[model samples]
Structures are given as C-alpha cells and as structure tokens.
Target: KSLTSAGRTVLNLALVVISSVAAIGAINLSTRESSDSSTFLLTADVVAPTLTLSNSYERRDGIVLGEGFYNDWGHLAEIHRSTRVEASTTVDDCLYGWTKVDTYGTETFTGYGDQVEMIFESVGWNGISLLIKCPSTEQTATYPVMVKYVRREIRLLNESDRSTFFDTLYTTYTTEQVDGERAYGKKFRSIKRLVSEHLLGAADKECDHWHDDAGIMTHHIAFTLEMEQSLQSIDKTVTIPYWDYTQDAYELDDWTDSDIFNPAWFGMASPSSKDHVITEGRWAYMSVGKQADTDGVRNPYGLLRSPWNTNPTPYILRHRYVYDEKDGGWTLPGCTDFSSAWSYNSLGEYFDELNGELHGPVHIMIGGQWWVNRTMNFSATNGGDFLLASKFLWRQGYVRCPELCSDDTPDDRCTCSCPDELTRYFRTSRDFLDQTGLFNLSDGLFSDWSNFATTGCMTPDDCFDTVVKALCHVGHAGEMFTSAAPYDPTFWPIHGLADRYLSLKRIQAHENETILSQMWSYSHDGNSPSDTRRVCDWSKVGDTMGLPDCYVGDCAGHRAQDLLPMGNFLDRNESYTNEEFYKFMNPRNEELPYIYDSFTQWPACTDQAICWWNTDGAC
Candidate 1:
C-alpha cells in the first residue's frame, strides 16, 4: 500500500515536529535550576547543535538537542571514601582412619580467609541507578556481594544555562527489572542494606528524602561482597542487576564520610560500551616512593610499581611521602587498612603540632583506583599486593612478611613489615613545615658559614636552632632571600636528620632507571614499529612521526601518533596494548578505541594480520 505524495508530505512534516518536541523536552529537563544564585542554565549557542528545527523556525545553529542527554560514562565525577571488610578461613572437616594397629587422624580443610581492606572508593550519582561489573570468578559464587553506596552534599548540576555548562555536565540514566524476576530486585535491596549498615541515614530507609532538596541530588553507592566474592579475580562478574530510584529511597542529610565516596557514582563499561571508559578512561596519579629504580627485587617500595609496570601505562608522579602526626601516622582509626589517605592524614596532624593546625588548603598525594580494575596486576591478593607494606620493606631493608609470616619462626628479617612501609612512604610529607623554620633546624646551603646574614642564624641564639630542612628546597625562600636550593640529596641515610633527604634522592634515581629501562625496551621491541618512537637518529617509514626532542628521557623516540589521536596526556609510562596498536595501524573500517575521544570507545582488535605482524615483527 503506497501512500500518495500528499500523504507522504504530511507524514514527513509530522516526523520533524515530533523530533523538535523531543529536543525541547530534553532542553527543559536540563534547564531545571536551583533556588540559589548559582542556578545553572544551557545557552542557545551551546545546545543549538544538538537540536533540530521545524519549517516555521530557522535552523541557523543546527542544534541537535538531547545528543548528550544520556549521562554516558565519559563526563561523570568520581567520589571515593575508604571502606573495609573482614573474612576468615576455618577448617571444614576432619576424619580418623585406622591403619595397622593405630588410628590416624585425617583432616579435610575448606577455609575462607576473612577479607578486610578499605573499600576506599566508588562511582555514582545520588539516588540514581547503579550497575557493578563484577568479574566472573569462582570466589564470587559463594559470597554473592552486598554492595553499598553513600551520597553526600556534592550536587550533580542540572546545567542548561551557561556556555561552559555542557563541558562539565553529566546525566543520570535508569534501568528496569525483568518481568516475574524478584531476584534482581532483591539483590539491589541487599546492596542498599549494606549501605544502611555502614552509612548514616541509610537505616531509616530515607534515601528517597533527597528529592525534596532545592539543589541537585547526590547519592553514593556502596556494596558489600559476600565471603564467596573475589574482587581481585578475573572470572568474577557482577552488575547492579537492579536499582530503586524512588525519591523516598534516598536521604542526603543522613549521608556521612563513607556515603560521600562510593563507586556507583561512576558506571563500568557495558558489554557494548567503551572498555577504556570503564577500565581506564580517567586520569589517575601514582605515588612513586624510592623503588622507582629497583629491579626484579620487589620490596615495600616496589609495591609502588604495580599498575604502571604491569597494566597499560597511565599518568604517573614520583615524589617522597610526607609524615604527619595528626592523622595518627598514616593510620585511619578503626580501620587497619593503609593507603595514601593515611599518609595525608598523618601529615595534617604533624603540621598541626608544629604550626597549630594549618589555616588553608593542603596538597595531598593521590593514587587512582582505575588500576584496581580486575584486568590490572593489583587486583590479586598476594603478599606483594600491598604498596604501603612494600615501601616500608624498601625503607627498613627487610622484615618477616606480616600478612604471610609464620608464627613458628621468630619474626626477624631485614624486610619491612606493613607499619615500616607506611613510615617510608611518608618521607617528604613534611617538606613545607621543615623549611619554614618551625622546628628551627637548618643545614646544607643555609648552614654555609659565609651566608650567616641570610641564614637568619647569625646571632648566638639562632645558631643553636635544630630543625631538619625538608627534602626539597621547593618553598618560597621569602621575599628578601635568594639562592633557594633544590632538594637534590647526593648523600643521606634512611635514618636520622638525613632520612627525608636520602629518600628524595633515591626516588629520583629510581625514576631515572624506570625511564631508561622502558626506553631501551621500546626501542628494541620490534612488532609495533609504530609503538616505539624514533627518539634516536633512526629513520622512519610512512607517517612514523616521533615526539619532539623535548622527550629526551622518558618519552624520547615516541611518535605523536603514539601519544595523540587518543588523548593528550603527558604521562610517558602509560603504554598501549597490542590490540590498540592493530586498530590504530588499520583504522579505515576498523572499530577503534582511539577514534572516539577516550580509550573507552576503542574496540579490541582481532585481526590475524595484527597477530602475525606482532609475532614476526618481534617487537
């Protein structure tokens, strides 16, 4: 049944009007503003590209509204707080068998180690749907997880106002349960129960109260893994399975610390979505202690080498750890877990003791959790999985493994225990206080006899001051002072006044070694001629573009294609996977991760050509 020309024209006109109305609906939703003066709005120019126009309205801007309407993975903010769990292994069964004239005791042991570690972070929006991508593994079978999420004061801006709104905006999307399936709904309820137990206001079932708030709502998602759950395993996989977004289900004021930082705020990649966004899209910073140079030997310091050394390389920063007495020496109260937070908290306390509590913002060390994705090296539970303990091992030289040590053997080894590692990680945390003369100790350049006037210690009383200077001379030496020295310690021990100084030097030296090792490996590994840049005088084939001479050390010889066309990150340590390279080399019809802005969109390649090329290419 073919329609006449008149009927066809009417249908076409109807379709255009419907699309326009839908676009308008999307705009209206995004433009809901707060009562405060900081209310957000979307500008005409910014959203015009996402909208379609009707015949009566001119399509001057060609805006296609709702294009970015869904809160996809790329633009969401991550809120993280430390959490913990406990697990223990117990003997399963025992039996006795008679042999000859004697009865022997036989034992069948099925033990489960109680798992406990700070669930430091989670990603999600307030009171919205959440999906967890639990890797498929044997451990997840027994202890189906009871995950929790907590949302705090942070608001998700409903921006429809300003030009910059779209740049920073994120959307919230939802999912529904299948017919006749109560299991999915029940599982989601279990997750909420865990959040209630650990977080405030969750117990009252008041999470829905957040809808009444005047501004954007923020709900944190948290989950508790059952004893059978193995978070570090590759085979274990789990998703939110379901969500309850009723306004009454969330209570923002009841949110606490644990509630503020939960993983559901950020979603994992779906089977059809971009892998990089779920696994490694955002920028994460690594804290490199002194092990940057260490070889096969992996001590406490070596733990710092995890993801960068094992997974695809990401951005990295190498610096000394600072110590603070306030945060209880990097130990969070009621939680035995150790992390960068413990270090920062300790430093904050230490500063307060010396300067009576700092009055302003403090720079804190950060370690990203994307590396915690099951695909990376840190996911496994092994003696060497701890960076905090490893840093201590490197600092103290050696000690019996605390988590894996034997009670029968005397706990004696040069190797560092967990506490010692925490100590080492905080090496330069006090650089600011040490340089401000709070403790009154001065050395090196400042101690120069010729520079008595500048040292501020020329007087008899000043000469006796004894505060050790920080590892780096990075502080402002004050207005009148000049010749502020850089903390390049040539000689300093791990103890006494020189401890911080020595650690700083050791870290730098190690970083240099990491750079050199990777450079050499990149140059010789031949499979991806495109992977290794021609940092040297080596000639190129085709569009083999190398980075500028500025990358002499770390990123030397790497091509612009090696860096750009994916993202413009400056971290040299992050490396591309073999699959990524195949797609890059042959990108015409190839579904590639590099093509769609972030690594999330890059599709994994399976070309036999790539396999043969890499194998025979020998790189």
Candidate 2:
C-alpha cells in the first residue's frame, strides 16, 4: 500500500540488510501504519507530522479503532504526527466537514524525534478517515489508513500473596463483584494453570507458547503468581521473592558467590548437579505435573541447573553483571533497550534474535541439561549450535525435529502492525542481507549499550541491529527445556528482573504506559514438524500470527465479546466458553499484578539511558 523499502541496497559485506523495507519477503510487519507517512515532499530542513485517520462509523473488523505514534526521530529536528478523520467527508472536502477523535496515546522526544500516539477503537472514530500531513512544510495531504498495538496492561501480582490475581486479570471484577474475597482471585490460578495444561497437553506441543503464553511475555509472571499462591496456601508466609542480579553489593557477596546456592534459598548441590534439584525450600517438597518431556511423564526430578549451581549467574554471562558505580546500575545479560529495539518494519524477522540472545540465555545457563547451552551460536535447523526451533516444536513431548525450519519452528511468523518507531532503526538503502537465508541473521551487536550506539554511524545501523542483540548467549537447558523452562522456580525471578527492565524502558521512553493491543498466533502445524512455514510464519515468544482470525488455544473462531473464558484442553472438556465466562475476557486496561522497582534515575552505561540523557546527570 505504501512505498515498501528493503530493496535496491548498496551491497557491503561488513553490513547487511536482513529484509527490504518493501516488506516483500516472508517477514510481515504491517502492524501499525506509519503515523507520519504522507504523500507530500519535504524541503531540506523542515519537520512535519503524518497521521492515519478514521472515524467511529468506519466499523470493519469487530470495531474500528486506530492508533498513531511517532517512535523514530532520525531525520528532522522537530517532527510531529497529525491526523484528521472525517465522517461523510474528507480533510480537504471541508464542504462536508469532520470531527477529531481524541485518542492520542503519549508523546516523547528520543533525540531522534517526537514519538506521539493515540489509541482509537470502535467508538473512537465515526466515519472513514484520512491522514493529512507531510514530512515538511506542505499543504494538507490526505491518504488511506488502518490500525493500533496498545500494550496489554496486567495488574501486578500481590507481593504479599494476598491473592488479587484474577480481579483485573483475565476477568475484570469490581470490589462489589469481588465480594471482598481475595481467595476468589487467587484461586483463578487453577484456570491459568488449566490454560497452561491445555498448552502443555496438546498432542503436538508448542511448549514455548504454553510455558510463556505469547502475550506481553507475561505468562511467566502468571506462572510465578500461581506457584507463589500454591506455596503460600501451605506456609501462608511464603511469597515469591526476586533475585536482583544487577545490584552492586548483594549483602550475600554479589550474584555469582551468593547464598542463593544455600539450601535455605535455592539448594546448590544435588546428588547430581545435572539434575541439580534444589534440595531445600518449598520447591524441593513440591512435585511437578507432567513436563513437556519425552513421555509427558512426571519423573519427579529435582531442579536441574548448570555448573555454576554453587552460586548464581554463570561465568558465561558473569561479565554482564558488572555494576556501574556511577549510579548503581548493572548490565542485563542479554538485555535490549526496550525503548527502541526491534520496534520496526518486521518484528517477526527479528523475533528469533531476541529469543536467541535475551530469553534463551536464562534457560540455558540455569538448566544445565539438554546439550543446548554448550553452543554459542545457532542455526535455523534442528541440530545446529543449539536446540531452538525443535524444542519449541517438540510440543507436549519434547520431540526432536529431523531438520526443517518451518511452522514447527515457533521462532517466526507473528502477525504485527509496526509503527514508525521502526523508522529510527531502518533506512531504505543498505547492504545488510545475504542469500544464506531471508532475514535470517546471526545477531550479537549489543556488546553493551555503549558499544551498540557507537558502532553504526549511518543508516538505521545504530537503530535496530546495533541494539537488539543485547541478549544473553543461548545454550542447553534454556534451549532444551525452553518449552516449560518455568518448571524450575528460578525461572520466575529471572523473568521478574527482565519484566522490571522492560517496564523501566517503557517508563523511560514514553509518558503513556497503556498497551494499545496485543496479538498472538493461534495457528499451529499439525502433529509433526515441517519447513514449509517461512520466517514470517513463526510466532516466537508471544507473537500473534495469521490475519483476521488468530487465537491462543481452544478460544479459536470466537468474537471479542463472546470470548471470555480460560484456556483448557478440548479433550479434557474442562474449558468454559459462555456468557458466564464473559467476565474473564482480557480487558486490556490499567490493572497490574506487579510493579517494577523504579530506576528512572539510575546511572548510564551509555547515552541510550533516557534519564541520563534527559537530565544531563546520571543520578
């Protein structure tokens, strides 16, 4: 529809373009229309805005709500995004006139430019709308439009373990509805667990999705709360605690040499470090359900971690723990500046990179088995440097793939509508792609925030490639048990830190925190594995794939209003899908289960740190 990029690049070996901006390849990123995309031309030094317009009357799919945001500021000094939606008329045909929709999300200036947004829904607009602006000073221009990706807001889990899980969770219940019974909310963990069970029990398991339910990457949080609830039910005083590995002094002698290894916390030595069962704590006594293992068997093994079991934070990624005394900030093993990383043209193309670098490391370093962590690099195939795609595809049984990178490989194909925030990381002409694979890349540019921002001088080079790879290296346990990595209690705390980091980035990047919308692909390849699915077909993490109709589990072919219920194995017939279930549909509003420890004023390892850049002071 718009001028596609990623083509006609000036070839260069040192630098490569994964995909053309035209979005011609398998990677699909039509998520959000560039809010600043216009048909007008700009004079040398002018900054203007472009907008996508629509009205409340233009109801197409379910309802018509549009979102606009300016996430990239690479070019002009002062850039803005503006939209004017008309009911029966156009921005130009004032003869019919139009009204403005007030759904502006949030705006911020990230050195590059101003990021502005508005979340619109069915009632937000009245009629068909048109975008009316250009990159520079020009007459009003009108263009066609569509879309929004509001982040999903999850109410923070009760740190006290008082049980406020489902109140605003899947189901929105007011105080009156809650009836003052906190246990009612806490008990919903069973439903959440039920969903996880359905996901894990699938004949052809998509363990990654189940282990981490492909939404805002919050499934792990859900798991943490469920486990905490279960444990608290027993001790009433046991609340899941977090391990802040990024701090300066741990009072326990830092991360690597801390008491986390003590049986009182997380037992270090097991009869076999290979099956490094935490011999102490409630986790030791707790028996787990059937894992996404070979026999779907309840083997009753202890928590298994890698060599650094005596302590936490494996040497493989220990350097990342270096503390920046300047402001008490430390490095995240494979952390990316969520503010700007991969928010571009094809989120799917780069999805695996994030997994390989960031999420993958936790599982590998912590879980010592699976022969996965041993390798530093990975290939799209099954038996590459690590067990990436195959593990995800192994489904409920940890089945291995013979070798093929297709639908079976959950590392790709999430349906997304990207925003102009992508513009900051990409420029049309570059020589970054190789025929070895379409958009397939070997990441690793984020040595640290400082190194990433300094490497690329031109192109969107400094934008996407430079920063997104700030992830921990991938290896075994994470690779092998990637599906249900959460079975290991340690998974919760690591994810907690990661989640906190993401929230920190969001708070640092924009003023608005409301998640416009989130989508996950419900499509799964039949029983066995296949290579037919392209890079765009994989839904790594929680990406939603397919177009008009895509869902997580048994909730397929359902409408937003009618789709209120928990996920359950159809074979078990334990799922609830009726008016009674309507109370549980994801409300996507401002309710959260946990709040991140604030670090808005933390020191900067580099300029990428928003607070440091804005205040001119690291503290």
Candidate 3:
C-alpha cells in the first residue's frame, strides 16, 4: 500500500494510460457510423438539449413536460387527494369544480411532438434529436450525454475532413415538413420503426414508469408509455400524433372539406374509409397498431374522422396562432388573435377556458375513439382498475392507468364494471366539455400574471384533472385513450403544443433560478428554493452518462440515487392519499429547440427565430 515517490509516479502513469484507453472507447462507440461513412461524431457543446430535461424521466430531452398542481402530487391519488378535489363530486358542481381545481403546473402534451408540428409547423422529439445529430456530425467526440460527463474521457476536436458527411446524413436520414425538401423519412411509412427505435433507444428500460409500468407517463420523462410494448407486440415501431382543430383558422371553412382530412394529414374521411387504414397523406400507406387488435395488423381500412362541427364549428381556431403546413414553417397569429383567451390571465383560465374552447372540442370533433355523444359514456366491464375509457376522467391522455385493465385488454375494451366509481372520479363528456361557464373565457390578459408567477409558488389545484379529462376523452374508437396511440404517427406534434406552451410561458415571464427561488422561498410552500430548478433540470445538481442498460439497480460503478425520484408523476392524481407535491419549475435555458412562429411574417433566421424544423432556411 505504501510506495516511494518514484514507484508512485510509475503507478500514476499506468493509470493515465488506462484512462486514455477508456476515453477512446467512448469516442469509438459514438462515432460508429453507418457502413457508408464514419464521419458523424457527437458531443455536448455543438448539440444542446432543447427538450425539457425533467429529472423524473432520466433527463431525456422533453417531447412532454409538467404543469398544474395535481400532476405534481408525488404519489397516486389513492395516496392523498383531498375531498374537495375528488372527480366524482366535482361534476355535481362542475363550474365550482373548475374553479377549485388548482392550475399550478398541470399542462401536458399527451401525444407530444406529434402532429401539427409534423405539418411542417412543429417539432417532435424524433425530429429534435435529428436536428442535434445533423449538426453534431461534424463535432468532435464527447460523452453520449452532456450532464456531469467524465471530465477528460471524451476529448474535443475542432478539425476534421471537409466532408458533406453530416449534411448528406441529414438529407438522407430524414426530411423537412410537407413538400419542403422531401428527404427520406417524411412519408411516415419508411421511418416509423426506425424513429421509434431511436427514441426508445435513448431511454432506460427498467427505470420505472413507461418502461416497466406497461404504459407511458411523460410529465417527468420524455416517454411515450406502453406504446413501445404495444408496438413490440405487433412488431411495429414508433409514435403517434394529436391534431388540434384550434391550431389553425378553419372554422370559417367546412373542416371536413379541408385537406386536413386528406389521408396525408388527419386520416381518411370517416364514412368512406374502412378498417382504420390511412390512404392519402404521408401516413396513408403505413401499418399501425389497433385498439381492438393486439397483433399489430395492417389497417385494412384507412384512418377515419367525422368532424363534430364541420358546419360552423365551435372548435374553430380561436386564437389564430397557427403553424403553417411545414414543420419549420413560421407561426402566424390570427388577424384577431385570441390565444390570450386560452393562454393569458391565470393558469386556471388556461385550463378551464380551454376545456370546451380548445381541448374538449377536439374530442367531439374527432368523434372517433373519444366520440362525445350522450348516447354512450359508460358500460359494464368485467375486470381491471382504470382503463383507457377512464383516462379521459383522469389525465390529458398523457399518462396511462394500466392497473385499470387486463393484460390482454390493455389497449382494448375496459371490461371493468366500475361505472359508478368511474363516474364519481371522471367528469361526463358533456358536463366537462361545456364552454358556457368558463373561469375566465374572455380575450383578456392576466395583467401582472408574469410578475406574480415569477415571484409566486405554483398553487396546486384540481382544474388540471378537469383539463386532462378533456384532452384525454375516452369514448371514441380511435387513438384517444390507449397504449397504441403512438403508432398513429400523428400523436406527437399535436401534443408538442403542451411542451411549447410551457416553454413560451417561461420565455415570456423571463423566469430564472432567482425568480423561481423567490417564488419557492417566498411562497412558503413545503419545497426548498433549490428544488425549483433541480427538480426541473436535475443535471445542474448532478448527472452521469446514463446507464448502458435499463437496469434499475446500481450499475456502471455508480448508484441510481434518483432512480425513481419525486413521485411517480401524479399516478393517483386526485386519488392519491398524500398531500405532498413538488412545486418545482422548468429550468431548460437553451433557445427553444422548437418554436411556434407566425408564418405570415416569414420568421427571420436571426434572433431566436432560426428555423428549427427547416432545411435551407437558417436554423
């Protein structure tokens, strides 16, 4: 154990050589290029995380994020939900319930980075990852993950052969939004599986929630839930997308007549289409999983959609904050923008007013899996806990309640005869979706909403539970509430709006650790000031090269200190027995990886407007 100075120097030299070899190994793993070229080398500096690196989800860049108080509740509702927040009783005083539901940080995008963003207007997780990769190909090697990387393991390099290698990889690997420059993966059919593999590949398998829980829960992680299992069962690959009717201004026109219903966009027209097969748009020619079938059969029938309000629709784009048909296309504000009606004022207003105004209308409009007719809201079932039908009663179709269903019926019919219990907790489609008694439905702004929020702790509420019911309505026959939604190809971008909303709010409020600390410290909430940022972006506190496998136990010479950190992301919602919730805030500081710009103005490449989803335009 004891060595002279010369002997110690020799030992240290050997240690240095061994370390150098390990560094080379990391570089080689990341640099393993396709057979054609080994030009792409990834690193943290050239590539930044635009996704919300929420601590709960192992820091995967977010295609989904958190909001509202109930969602932040650390345990399942059975753990500690208060009497005032119970879902069953709230419907009795629906308006009163809306007012009582806390709006803390419950905002979520169920089918995140899904559609709309794919319409050449938004950016999905798969898309975001691609952006980072395309540019970073020319980069020097570094650790796979940026946070708390081994200091000298991955060496830096500023020089390389002048190869069009990265650019070629970009064009060949994927494409820009609709008709932009049509590269390789735009057709939806070609890249579905690969994209799925890529996203799941970035995650840890056994780290809890979506991985082993049999469903996806992305409030704290950038996961797509049991979708992967469903896809795996069918030997399929990938994600789904959600299409909101309010994102564009088409109430004036017949929605059914619009191109959105074209096979390339939302799906085929409901009446004429059969077997749930999509026929026209980019997704027209692909195979996707089904709610009724588990074998992952090819949808013999094309996708279907019968807009509830094709004629003078109430779901018309209320705020005119539209993303053009291209992924990187500019975002345009309405001639008479009304987003303030949905986004401004109190956070509660954002959720309550948006129920029917923004969230609920989409359910009724789709009238598919989440069909909204008084004719059907419940039926007797034989087994399980809360199923897909009940998701609408709970979350924004964001997290899954697998305990509510049988393994065989995971994505199918919920045979559970718990209607009374379901009814008690979940709001009726009609009562929950009413647009008349909104908390603050006017087109007014929350005067000093920014400043107060900046200096205030997020007040937890049940309003988020109500919004979840609206966003995740379960009556329809399609993808509304199921583990297989991601297979649809349209689910991600539609939900990307949720992620975008929070990012925009953070931008508008000019929030930071100082502001968040002021709120957490001054608000007198149970959480300490440091938790605000650490909870949102834990890497600041500490991080490591994520484990090589999905192992939940200690591995790779490090312990999983936060293996299942800070609650299982409101699994119980109002059903939990605990009163505790993480009153933390989002801490991502990079220029938004994605933005909803005004297309009419042709957003410039300068400033924070670089075309995040573009090809030729300066991104």
| Model 2, TM vs. native | 0.36
Q: Identify the superior model by lDDT, candidate 1 or candidate 2.
A: 2
| CA displacement after TM-score superposition, residue 122 of candidate 1 (Å) | 27
Each prediction's total of clashing residue pairs, residues at least 3 apart in sequence or on different chains, is 106, 71, 83
> Is candidate 1 or 3 superior in TM-score?
3
Using TM-score, rank the candidates from best to worst: 2, 3, 1
Overall lDDT per candidate, in order of appearance: 0.19, 0.28, 0.24
Candidate number that wins on TM-score, 1 or 2: 2
Model 3 spans > 4 angstroms off: 1-247, 269-271, 274-276, 290-360, 370-476, 481-483, 511-588, 591-619
Model 3 whole-model lDDT (C-alpha atoms) = 0.24
The candidate maximizing TM-score is 2
Mind giving the per-residue lDDT tens digits that candidate 1 earns over 439-557? 22222322332322333434533332211111111111100011000000100000111111112222223444211111112222211111121122223322222211211222311
Top of the candidates by lDDT = 2
Instruction: After superposing candidate 2 on the true structure, give the runs of residues whose Cα lies further than 4 Å from its correct spot.
Output: 1-203, 206-218, 225-240, 248-255, 269-275, 279-356, 370-385, 389-480, 508-590, 597-617
The Cα RMSD of model 2 versus the native structure comes to 23.3
